[model samples]
Every structure is written in structure tokens, then in C-alpha cells.
Target: MKKEIAAVVFFLKRLIKKAEKLEAEKVDLFVERLTVALQEKFRGHWYTDNPSKGQAFRCIRVNRFHKEDAELLRACVESGVQYTDLGLPKELTLWVDPGQVCCRYGERNLAFTVASFSSDDSDDKEDVTKKVTSAVERVTSDYHSGSSSDEDNGCREPRYITGFSHRPPYQQSLLCHRMAGHVPVFCGDRGDSRRHVVLAQ
Candidate 1:
């Protein structure tokens, strides 16, 4: 009876050690993939935030599109890892700062700083996953439709983006045309100027 109990304890210890090892490897792989995505797609930097905090690895910051989701999501997918694994919150909310996007995973929550939008309540995993999927689909569609192969291969000109979401259809169409590199002459100005647009990706 004593020998059997000792053997059981030893086996359990070995299994626990194996599980820890696997978890460590998974964390390492996640970090590596994230780093690559930041460097290649966003031309950004990735580094550890602090070693003392639990699962607090790194946050991404880019010079351009720091407040935009399209480039960030593209980088996430290009990393070839799941968003959850990358420590994205189930109820993802982006808080904005000047010229930088930030995120960190904690034991209790996932924090992101990118835009003004936010949510206190966490959503179900399935719901969050679906939202991310749909958003990625939209981004992919926009990428393929807006830019051609030549433009994609060549040096991308800086884009002037206006807050066209609230604008009327004609204005939105005009901006879209501009986005596609067609400089259509507008004979009359309705009090809108180039100062209103922000230079972005």
C-alpha cells in the first residue's frame, strides 16, 4: 500500500512538470509569432513590458495607423496565430494615445490602448471570435478592392483619410476615388479643405 502511494505521487509530479513545459513552449511560440507580425506588417517594435507581471509580454506601437484596426488585424492574422493566443480580450476595446497602439494581457483582463471605444463587460469567447472574423473579412475585402498589383508592389503613397463615415454618399464616393489614386477635380468647395484630412497609410 505504501509503495503504491509513493509511485502514484511520483507519476503525478512528472505529469505536472510535463504540462508546465508545454505551456512555456506555447508562450514562447506566441511571442515569436507576434514579434514577426509587428516587424513585417506594421514595421513596428515588440519588446517585453515587464518580467514580474504574469503573462505581461509586449505591446505593439507603430508610427502610422496607430489608431486604426485594419493594419493591426492584418498583422495579427499574418502572424499565423489565433487572436486569443495573442492575448486579445474577449471584449476587445481599443483606447487611443498619441501615435501608438498598445495592449497587454493580465491574469484578470486584457488591456488595449488604441482608440476611444471601450467595453467593461467581457463577451463570450464565441461572440468575440465571430466579431474578429467578420472584421478581418471586411479588411481583406477592402485591401483587394482598393489597391491594384502595381500599387501594392510599388512604394505606397501616403493616404489622406477623412472622417467619411459620417459624411454623405457623394462625399464618401469622392474620398474613395481619392483613396484609389484618382485626383478628381472639384470645381466648388463646400467649406471642406485639405486641413481636415489626416495623412495616414
Candidate 2:
């Protein structure tokens, strides 16, 4: 689980480096420092999908408009790096789109949503991963399940995901990107049914 999280962070940092075209040594230094900042202060709110609204992606949201961005910026300043040059935006969101397992971290809010997939009540004993499992089922079923009335109605079903299981998805740590190197902003709003696959906390 730690390896999966690390892989995701590494992938995002690499994209930032390439986009900014930083020197190799500088990339290493900045990424290292930024990683520390993230580990220390990157608070994420995990959200499940809203399939009823035709939304099919699950995401972990970090509102950069809040104090988290400031901590990250302070980390950059201490490391003698400019934050804007890194091209991170006012919001950082990580999403698991349909048919993909790994997360896509982005600079913009996917869109405003009002789906109540989660409970704010304190009596809820389920962990975040349990709450997120149905969404993963929808994702994985997209491959095996044929076209349904849902698709005909212009609604996309959520697809497969990994690293969320009590059973390991793979014996070895394999880094796979569903989309090739492009940081895309998919405009849509989407959840899970059927079998539940719980994610590690």
C-alpha cells in the first residue's frame, strides 16, 4: 500500500518536472523536499462516485485554496524553489477514472458535486476503503459487462482499480498509467454496486 502511494507521488512529481523542464539535480532536490511536505501536510478527503448523477470517478481531493497549499509553498521556500514555477494549481485532486486502477492527480477541481455518497455522521463504523469499494466494482465490471441501458443513456460505468484489495492485486509492484503521460481534466460527475472490494487504510 505504501509502495502504491509512493508510485503515484513519483509519477506526479515526474510530470511536474518534465512540464517545468527543470535541471536533473534540481528535480531531485525539489521532489525530495516536496515529498516531505506532502507526507507531513497533504490532507486528502476521499470521495466515492455518484453513479446516479452519471458520475463515474472516485477521487481524493486536496483543496489547494486552503492551508495545505501554503504549507507546501513554505516547504518550497525553505528549499529555495519557486512554487508557481512548479505549476501546481489552487486545487490538487487525485482521481480513479473508469477502467483504470492507478490515480490521476490534477490541478483543477473535476467539477462541483452534490452527491451524498458519504455520511457525515459519527456512528459510521466503516473505514474509508470500505465505503469506496462499490465504486471499484463498477469500474472492474465495465470490461466484462457488455453495453447496458446505462451506457445507452450516455452514462458511463466505473471501471477497474487495484491496490484497494485485502488480497494484493499483484505479486510485484507494477507501475501502470491508464492514460499515457497526459494530465487530462475529465468533466463529468459518477459509484459502486455488486461485490465490494475493500481498500487498505
In terms of TM-score, how similar is model 2 to the real structure? 0.35
lDDT of 1 by residue, 32-53 (tens): 4434443454222222242223
Residue range 1-201, candidate 2, lDDT tens digits: 222234334544544554555566666777677556554542332212432221222333443233245444655677677666654432344433222224322331123211122233442324333323433333224423433221233434433333333433342122222222222232121143222322111
Candidate 2 minimal-lDDT segment of 10 residues = 108-117
Per-prediction TM-score to the true structure, in the order listed: 0.26, 0.35
lDDT of each: 0.35, 0.38
Q: Which stretches of candidate 1 lie over 4 Å from their true place?
A: 1-118, 139-180, 187-201
Residue 136 lDDT in model 1?
37
The candidate maximizing lDDT is 2
Candidate 1 vs. truth: CA RMSD? 17.0
